[model samples]
Target: MTLLPDLVSRAAGRHAQRDAVVMGSRRLSYAALEQASNRLARSLIAHGVRRGDRVALWLPKSPEAVVALYGVMKAGAAYVPVDPGAPPARMAWIARNCEVAGLVTCADRIARVDEAFAGRPPMRALWVTDDAADAPRVAGLPTVTWPALAAESAERPAVPAVDADLAYVLYTSGSTGDPKGVMLSHRNALAFVEWAGDTFGVTSEDRLANHAPFHFDLSTFDLFAAARAGAALYPVPPRLFAFPAAVAKSWCEQRLTVWYATPSTLVLFLTRGGLASLDLSALRVLLFAGEVFPVKYLRELMRLAPHARFANLYGPTETNVCTWYDVKGIPADDAPLPIGVPCCNDEALVLDESLKPVPGGGAGELWVRGATVMQGYWGDPGRTALALQSIEVAPGISDRAYRTGDIVRRRADGDLEFLGRRDHQVKTRGYRVELGEIETTLHRHPAVDEAVVVAIPDEEITNRLKAVVVTRPGAAVSEADLRQHCAATLPRYMVPEAIEFRAALPRTSSGKVDRRALQELSS
Candidate 1:
């Protein structure tokens, strides 16, 4: 299927009576989901949402959220997913940045939406999943209830989207400023989905768990792969994420055969989630990505789930998934598993600063070129061009490739071993963050003179962000006060878990901040 909506339509035709999505006690059949999305699509068109328009989806993970995703695509619009747990300011910034034409959310969250808009949102219309008499109504913008939309004609709308059309826009942290949207086309997403399906041999009998949030790229495989194979997609409740025992019980209860999530999440289950003793007999495939799986955790997990096949999938959000490594039994305590070979239709090259290939397994920046590369950052051509560059692969042979900004060493066997990033960027709890961004936000505080942020590795949490700030002479600021300041302007994940106030910061010979000194302090 070229367009993403076609996946849903074709699945509905084949698995009409089969369950397409399961959330808690609610189950939506393929036919029912298709009809629901069709009605919602018609309502969107009625409310002046034209093709190529952007629609924002802000809601807790639920069956209706899934329906709205497909509905937005069916209307020939790209859906922008906003994390419901995001601060009001972050939400507002994302909606404003994307210039969303409308919003799809629930009644309970209308207050947050209003707070985000600050009484004057740019959206032209709003669709509340549940519209009760008590639901707050905004002035000027037309409001449509879920029931009202469901009452509209269920006939499929003729949206005419092609493979080249934008499918979705996922926002990630930016090094220069706030978050930037990564624009992905239908072709980019389908390339990864088709590869995952064929690689894993997914079938209708498989039951997959949607562990990642809709805003995360990992959810793309869990959602589309299941649909492509006519399999059941089970949406794991967000609340159960903290309680490992409950998460394990839910996995067993749902009889999930395929699982995908961050390595930190899997480690949480094994340590605190009581997954080691649980009966996961039906689980056949286990996939982890987004961060480096600690060697100790990887060995322990392999011992616990010997019956399951484990694989490490690695890539940045800019490129869906470039390389994958399937675990071959258990490894030594010091051995880190390679990131493995490139997926179908993809290639990974270790190139130097001049875009020349590194020889004899030397460490260099990892660059990738493939159908899975995103089209570009939305509305930011300059930044897109910088990230996407043309590099010569052979004598006078060149291809446009994404500069991954990661350093890795190639093994003799053609496997790639990940080292670290080329910049201050780090992956903490499956989310990519720019240390300079946090320091920039910290510098905004009046009492702060200089600040440096570093990623501190922890046993339990993969990595924790720590900030060391040097206050202006005689200016006093408590950690609590600085944390509150950050919490107000930044997302919860971006906030520093630990803060230190120092009288002065160490500097290098050239007067630049000595980040290595700060690292030693954290250590």
Candidate 2:
């Protein structure tokens, strides 16, 4: 279990003929997946991808995304998955920042991406996916269609020389900015998959449903962990999430034995009237991560599927997943339970300003240590050093610990309760944000002279962050217009709650926008 390729090999040997992935009519067994990845690995190497090189994958959530991911790792190159649906500018930013050597994308999406990174980060080659009788989008830089490359490459791949190198860099939406690439090493990803499989008791008989996007780290649990168990990974289309009741019944019909999704996804199931009639009798395990699971929803879920085991997982994209809380049932008080503690070889502790562990029930910053931590931001050493630090919190253990920047308190029972982020950063709808990023985006608005965005704790949705701005000398600025501007540039979530106009924004002696004063004025 030292690497991801080992997991694929072991599972193939154990369950060579079992259905590993089921997407509509598309079926791939463990043996087929391993063999395809091996061929793809060879194909990658034949095209000049060496060990530790960055291979970018910009594709839809199909068998190709899954195979290409394993293939990049098998070729000993770090895979960087850019959401095929992401705005071209963001994708370009990620490619340039990560310095990707090659790009694997569909013919349809080739032009935009090519145009984005054109004249910027010099990409060596483009591997275009040929779905049918499709042409090779040959209008760009050195291009080789996927079918041709695979046909020319040897089916058996040469073992690459790599150990503890990066597996993939997952770029997640920033609450305030574009997106940050969470640099995950092979060890970091493998740690999470191994722990998730063991903790959830995944077996060959288990059928897990994958609803999250391929770009999100949560999808790792569904695809890799389930594949490792020789279990069927049922790919749920984005459309099904929109109509959750139909989807839930479909899962029950498929006899899905395991399920994992963000809290919002499952809440949609209940809200859309799907859970009441569905026989989730086949579902034995249920895991919700990403955002906070409402206690009422958890209780309802337990009531609907009494025999199913429930687990709440928590972690940022930088760290795959460090902590989990097992829900036997809801607490009588109905407050969302603590995220529990670290899993497997991972460790967690609350530290004060000086990095000393706080006493039980004392509040402090949550710092995580072990194999689960990421390598840090790709290519940005300043941000990396600020996040990943070395602190001796426990006896005889001193490694580069990642300060989660999340304020937490150790309960008398020894579990840590998440008390929100230490800064203006917030997690709304399962996406992380930095207030400064939103403010920066807002400042770009033509009329916006000064902007300060803050996360206002909301009762309805965990917290709705609102932005307040000062118009430039009687400039005609409407909240609606600014919101529309955000929609065009930023993702929908990153859009401000409101854009309030003020005579003059509160400023510090140094002439910086004082967020504290803005909060006071708004209150």
Candidate 3:
């Protein structure tokens, strides 16, 4: 298929009556999904959503959300997914930054949506996917309810788009205190989806677990790969994450054949999900990514599900899964696992500060060149230029590649061993976060004079964030107050796990904040 919607169209023809998406006993057949998405697309088009316009999805993960995303793309517009649980201010900032022409949200979030767009140029349209009868209408905005949306024509829209056209934009934390949107085209997503479907040998008989949130890149594989292979997709409920046992039960009940999620979630399952007592023989392929998988926990998981094969997928949002490693046997030790070779028709290069390839066995930043790399950061040319640069692939031959900013060392066996990040960016619970972003938020508090955010290494979640702050003289701010302040503007995951008030932040002789010392203190 040349475009993303083509996946759904082909699947509908091939597996018309087969289950496509399943959420809490609600199952949508391939034909039904196609028709629903087509109707939604027509609704969007009728509301003035034109080709190339940006549409934002701010709903929780549900069948309606899935339909909304496909419908947005079918309307010849790229869908920007906003974290449904994020603060209204943050979501509004993203909406404004991308200049979204339309939004798809639920009744519960309409108030916050109004708050977000209060004084800004109103969106062209707002779609409420559920509880429309009780949803309060906002002034000066055209709102469509589920009933009205469903009444639209089910025939596919005739809007023209190409494989290179934008498909989606995912926002990631930025060092400058604002989230940046990573633009991916249909070809970019198809490259990775095609690879994942082939690598795992997904088929209509396969039941894939969609554990990652739609906003996360990992969900791309879960969503598109299933559609590509005509497999059934089961979206794990977000609330089940707090109860690992419930998560395990859900997988067992679904008889999922393929499972993909972050290491932190797997660790939770291993420790408390009661996997030892469950029947997981149906799970055939297991994939983990977004952070280093502690070898101990992974090894235990391997023991628990001996029939399943596990692979570690690695890449930044800029390049969706550039490399991956298959666990052939039980890990020998607690040493970090290699990220393995490049996948999805991608090339990986270990380069030094000068952009020259690093000699074998030496550590350097990882650079990737391939079809799967993102188009660019949405609306930010300077940052895009800095991330995507022309680097030498061969003698007198240079190609555009994304600088991953992740440090790695080539193993003696040719595999790339992941070292760590080259910057203050860190992964916590599979979410990429910039320490400077949190520090900037902390500084915004009137009582804070100086603030720094440090990551403390943890085996379970990769790293736990801790905030150290120096208050302005006589300014009384408790840790809870600072945390509440952060919660107002940041996602729950980005909020510092622990906050400390100090008389003064330790500084280096050169007058810079001693981050290293702060990390040591936090640890």
Candidate 4:
């Protein structure tokens, strides 16, 4: 009953005549969306996708992307939505790592898809939703166009799935140079969906503005919560993401009742997006996550959108939004906004190194326990075991808990206030970035001998990555050359904002690269 497709099926039946998805000039009714997905589901089944098989989606945010999502789930396959903007090398790694059964994308992206799958194990099929006329051919792989894929009957497939079955596998940056898939089950997604639907009082009348990319965990709430409440999902187009003013205009034109994005996105709108001039009388709930919102920009947003209720959500991809804070009012510019309390069916615990609860509300690592915690990292049991530890909650009573590497302190009001990270992982514009991954990419360039990536927090760039590189003796390379090398392998956000060349890296007594000393150099 708690399966992911169940949510879609129920919403389509209940709101059959209502708008289910709105993208630019296109609007899809629930019945139409359901039937289209059913056809796609049948297509996936005919193409040999089975229960638990990974179906990768490397498409942009559109009605077709939404259809592919539900269709793959309806076929009892776990959907893996890769950022369409991902580098070919990264995409290839994910495709091989997951052994994806099929990929749903457009004709325009076929060349990149071919490049990603060039030397890897073959993916079964490629389903192009837009066109197939100019689509590049990949050896031994059949290309199915939209019209041909829809030739299959629109009858629902009887794929066996349950609450425990995986709904999606989202790959995040790994410290070990590659990406790791965080396996989330239907039950895991439902925990946040149900909680968010109730918490925000969402209904069919409300329209949701989805700003986060499909691959991001934040988009989970935007997609599922809307379906849970039988509401309409309005996606922010990829190009509009860059032009903050256009984003503000779209928000007003769409009359979005609920808006959710990273704090940086919100800041962009307030500072330069013409948000002050917009007629946003329809906006209600405004939610932010992925990175800490500076109190200054937050206050300005509050002042402008005084009618909207603001909230802050906190969690890692391993746990989908365990805690949330509904802003009561604007606090002082210097005050820290707490991550707040646990969501429904979830518990947040502050623990020390020994796994015991932290004493006297002191700073400690945050551990999440409950339904929202992920099943585990896909195909990496050793790392999974390290992250998911068993903690005795009540003497003999124990539960599986995710050790979030965030340092936080429980406040006098019983809310958890985030202090900082315990590791090199930092959030850049709401995207979780592993500094080690950037360092690994820098090492790929033939010029450098040693590299260390550090986060330099700023008011404008948020948490930008700064790379300190030591080139091999007599191997000359400019900062631009190194940047181009990183750009070829990494996503735009993961690329270092600034690079510093040095004769040699600072070291500690143990003869290891001293990141702390390097931090001082950056400051």
List model 1 lDDT by residue over 1-523, tens digit each. Answer: 4688788888999988888998888999889888999999999999988899989998889899999999998999999998777777887888998999899989988877887787898888999988645798876778898878757888889987788888899998888758889998889889999999888888988999998989999999998999888889998887776687897789987789999999878888888887877888889899999988888888888787788889899889889988999888656556878899999488999998888899999999999998888888888899999999988878887888999999998999999999988898988888888888788889889999988998898776668999999899888889998998888767788899999887788899999988998898798
Least lDDT summed over 10 consecutive residues: which range in candidate 2? 131-140
**Candidate 1: where are CA atoms >4 Å away?**
none
Q: Please give, for residues 85-134, the per-residue lDDT of candidate 3 as tens digits.
A: 89988888888899999989999888888876784545788999985887
lDDT for model 2, on a 0 to 1 scale? 0.78
Predicted structure 1: clash tally: 1
Give the Cα RMSD of candidate 4.
1.3
Clashing residue pairs found in predicted model 2: 175-433, 176-438
Cα deviation at 174, candidate 1, in Å, is: 0.9
lDDT of each: 0.87, 0.78, 0.91, 0.88
Which candidate number has the best lDDT? Answer: 3
Error of 3 at 522 (Å): 1.4
In the range 391-507, model 2's lDDT, one tens digit per residue, is 886599678888887899988887779887677677676666677778888888899988888776543345577888888986997999998777655656778877787787788
Compared with the true structure, model 3 gives a TM-score of 0.98
* Stronger candidate by lDDT (1 vs 3): 3
